[model samples]
Target chain A: MSNLVQTITQSRIWRSFFRHGWPDNPLDRSLVMTSNIFFHLHPVKVNRKSLRATYTFGLGVMAVILFLELTLTGMLLMFYYAPTVERAYTNIVALQTQTPYGQLLRNLHRWGAHLMVLVVVLHMARVFYTGAYKPPREFNWVLGVGLLLLTLGASFTGYLLPWDQLSFWAITVGTSVAGYAPVLGSTAKAYLLGGPEVGQEALTRFYALHVMLIPLGIALITSVHIWRVRKDGGLAANDDR
Target chain B: MTNIPTRTPFSKSSGKTYTLVELVHRAPAQMIDHGPENTVFAFPVVALLELLLTLSVSAVLLFMSLTINAPLEEIANPNQTTDPAKAPWYFMGLQEMLEHGHPTLMAVVIPTILVLFTLAIPYIDNDRQGSGRWFTSERGKRIARNTAIYALLVMPAFILLDNSFPPRELLRGVVPDFVAQTLIPGTIMAAIVIAPLLVLRRSKPNAREVVLTLFTLMFVSAIVFTLTGFLFRGPGFELYWPWNMPDGYNPFMNL
Candidate 1:
């Protein structure tokens, strides 16, 4: 059995599939992180201090996880949802009452979105309180601010998708605040609503942004964000200099 | 099992080694200050931790989804407007601020300033004295705590005071619109924010401590306004006890 396993492991096909052997040793462990795309976001070795629960409260990780949850549930929701004034509300109602576990999916997406926003804000506060935004991490902190804005954009756009009274008025009130800006307010508001008020045009535009543009932007920026963290020598907790 | 060698085989003591070169003062190597003694491989540990977090978060979310349904109101109607329409919970801070001052100042200008300040925080206070520690020092922690408490008390008072005696209404004929809506409220807010800094001047606070006070004040005030907008504001946008909203106006219904 050992000979057979060794033969299979030594084959070209297996070698092509995995760059490293079982990660039981230090070399393989290091290789495993550097070799795998997903694992490469993390460092080969992390500071023990960075792993402390109290230090970070894992808020950053929680934010990323929540984003992932939102993405998954969001995609599932897109299958049944349509970006139309006529069908959007009925789609949601039918999704809740007619489909199996659809309500659970919608609930998860809605709450996960709220949780993500809260988690992101808390993560920023944690980073601020810890003075983690110092020096080399400054640009990453800027990126973080952009991420926060994008998060708000994603949530705000998604809020209008249901085409219900709650969503419609919430967005109207929200965007009216934008219209309060001096020169560009009304123009920006018009562009956002695609007209004078919330209607079919606004719904379609928001749907496109909520599903496509914003998520892609988030994914791209998140990639750079994690990469910058790795390049900046892991978390600031590890830095004594 | 093959042992991975970390250090190079070539050494100064070796008989055939090259001559010693002068050490140059340059940026230190990656691991100069710390060693592997205080570190662990991220593969298994971080992966496991992430998996645990994912499971726990999902479990909580799933339980929430099962127990409580997401709120859904009636179909959209352009003619029939909902009384006291509000923004989402996150933007409730801005919405609440709208109740106090001019919309341009409350919604646009102040939020823009806050965002810019948030982004410029690192540049504004670039000191590296206390990177990893929470609140930087004891003084910082104290400043943050005191500022938070100050904001919690002062903001509610400001809201109540401003609501009861709105300059926009009180000085209708006496003062200009901009003066009443913009200048007066803006000046009062600036005074409220700057009061702590004036008190801290005696202690000779550092930039980090100063920023700490300001950030804490703004953050806590934002929370106060948000909670007030989200939970306290009932039908007609009047401040009420969250538990005793009139006309069966449950604020959670809006969520």
Candidate 2:
């Protein structure tokens, strides 16, 4: 009983916890390392040679950062937005005139969305340049390509939510273009808009899709992307090159 | 052990001069080690932290969603068309092309072709088997550069030549319907996508040349497109609209 008490009280973990930050048990470490929910999202011990100050392959990080900015700013903008035609324009005006920091929030959300698209494209380019999209990593690349389309899709759907002349007609013509799909264009266009032309039905449909459907798609594909990164041997080693 | 002395001639390429059923098989650091360590510190906390982060982000978005509403406009009024029935901004590049063409061409077929071409990128560039090493070789790089440049360059030049009305005037001018709009633009779109592969197939450009050509063409397309788009709006063309506007109220009248 006395030895057990001493072991619990005087252990290195206890002492370390008392003095510093973490108790990195390799098991605890392995737990963090191998646990799917957390593990796949992080770099599993990177190659030392790849860690230069100017690692050009770091564009993926920039893309993630841009995505995060979009999410945060987009959420803030949601506070004043209404997905209805009757109130959307007024609500946007109210967001600009009534809400404090509204302009800043709007700018952040708008610009962030634009910038995220640009960054994601650059990220794809960087991955291509460094040969990060090779075997063992191809599926992730495909997921990434899907994610790219989703990003464009989300941006396209959300573009309509603003209900401005630019946003509305843009979405109108956009969905109308969808109506031209050869065999299913009619059904696809109607389904997308929830009715015929871009209107209340279209707005409602885009709203549901932008807020719910597309995001779910992103989350599902992102998991696969992170997993492939791990299985791809932790970034391109660049050793032989 | 019996044949070790007699079989030493062919060992140089094998890294070691001898091996076999009698060779030792333990790692230097673990020759006598028996059990795997039960370390358990790295996994749980990081996962918990990530979980926390994801939830926090989700929570914030939820709060915002609850507080804010997405925008809605006046219900669709068929009589009130906005001129330049603009495309989704991402398609701004394509909408900018429609000013000179027909409905089916600008609105449907061309865009579909462009998207289908985009989706084909993975299939078209399928050369990933690389002995566990580089995914792209010199040939691949050249192909990519050429493909990207062709789109970036040829698109603007075609748009310019079209909008310049040089050919439009000569070819009987501004014909309506899918035949006039869709077919020509679709063919042009297809050619823009196909030109690079045609230019660089089975031919290699060095890394520097590839990168430079790609950027140069990208810059040229963007610059020419913007310059022509903004600097060269015309008075004669009928702009497409989402809603029907009262005739003569063309919003682009000033431009």
Candidate 3:
């Protein structure tokens, strides 16, 4: 049995699948992390202070996790939802009452979105209060502010999907604020709503933005954001100066 | 027992070529005083923590989804508007700000300034000394705490006082629309934000400390305005106790 196991483990196919052997030793452990794309964002070795629960309270991790959850649940919801003035509300009603576990999926997406916004805000507060945004981490902080705005954009766009009165008026009131801008106010508002007010054009635009554009921007920016965190020498908790 | 060779090929004693270049007196290049003993391999440790967090957060969200249904009101009708047509909860701060001053100032200018200021913070306070520690020092902690409390007390007072005795209403035709809606409210809001800094200015605060005051004040004021808009306001967009909203209006139903 041992001989057969060793033979399989040393085979070229197995080696191709995993670059490193069992990660029981230091060299293999380092290879296990540095060799994997997902793990490469993390350093092979992390400062113990940076890992302490109280230092970060895991808020950044929570935000990322919430984003992933929102994406998952949102993808599931897309199967049932259609962005149109007529079918949108009806589809939502059918989704809740007809489709299996559909209401649950919608609920997860909704709550997860709200939670992501809240968590992202709290994460910013944590970074600020910890003085983590100082010095070398400046660009990452700016990226984070961008992420916050994108988060708001993502949530606001998703708000209009159901074509319900709540979403309609909410978005109308929301976009009217954009119309209060100096020169580009009315033009920007017109572009956003696709006309004078919320209609099928607005729904279609918000659908593309909420599903494709904003999430893509978030994912791209988030990749760079986390990469910058590692490049900036892990969390500020690792710093002694 | 047979005698074994002490100097193995890879052993230090059998070194064929080696060099001791130069000795430098400084902390390590990447890590300051930290050594191997102060760190851990990120493989299983960090990865497992992340997995555990993912599972727990998913579980909590599942529970919430099972119990609470997301709100879906009547179908869109351009003619029939809701009594209090408010924005999403997050934008409630901007909506509430619209109540206080000119749309140009409240919705566009002030928020624009705040966002730009937020982005400019690290550059403005480019001090590298207090990067890791919370509140940087005891003085920073006190400043943050005091600023938060001051915002908590003063912002609501401003909102309430402004709501009751609106300058636009009182000075109708007596003052220019710009003065009543824009200049007066703008100056008052700026003064409220700057008062704490002026008080701290006597002691000559560092950049980090100054930014700390400004950020805390804005953050707290944001929360106050959001709550006021989301919970306190009711139909006709008038102030009421959150629980005492008339016409059976539940602010939470909007969520």
DockQ of each: 0.76, 0.21, 0.79
Looking at model 2, give its docking quality level: incorrect
**Recovered native contacts, candidate 1:** 0.81
List TM-scores for all candidates, in order.
0.94, 0.65, 0.94
Query: If the candidates were sorted by their lDDT against the true structure, best first, what order would they fall in?
Result: 3, 1, 2
User: Best-fitting candidate, measured by lDDT?
Assistant: 3
Number of residue pairs clashing in candidate 1, backbone atoms closer than 3 angstroms, sequence gap of 3 or more or interchain: 0
Q: Write the per-residue lDDT of candidate 1 for residues A1-241, one digit (tens) a residue.
A: 9999999999999999899998999999999999998888888999999999989998988888999999999999989998999999999999999999999999999989988999999999999999999877899999999999999999999999998889999999999899999999999999989999999999988998999999999999999998998888788888654
Interface RMSD of 2: 7.7
Q: lDDT scores for all predictions? A: 0.90, 0.57, 0.92
TM-score of chain B as predicted in candidate 2: 0.45
Report, to 2 decimal places, the DockQ of model 3: 0.79
Tens-digit per-residue lDDT, B1-255, candidate 1: 134333325453434335433453434433566767999999899999999999999998999889889999999998878877889999998999999999988998888999999999999888766778888888789889999999989999999999999999999989889999999999998899889989999999888988898889989999999999999998899999999988888888887
lDDT of 1 at A107: 95
Chain B TM-score in candidate 3, rounded to 2 decimals?
A: 0.90
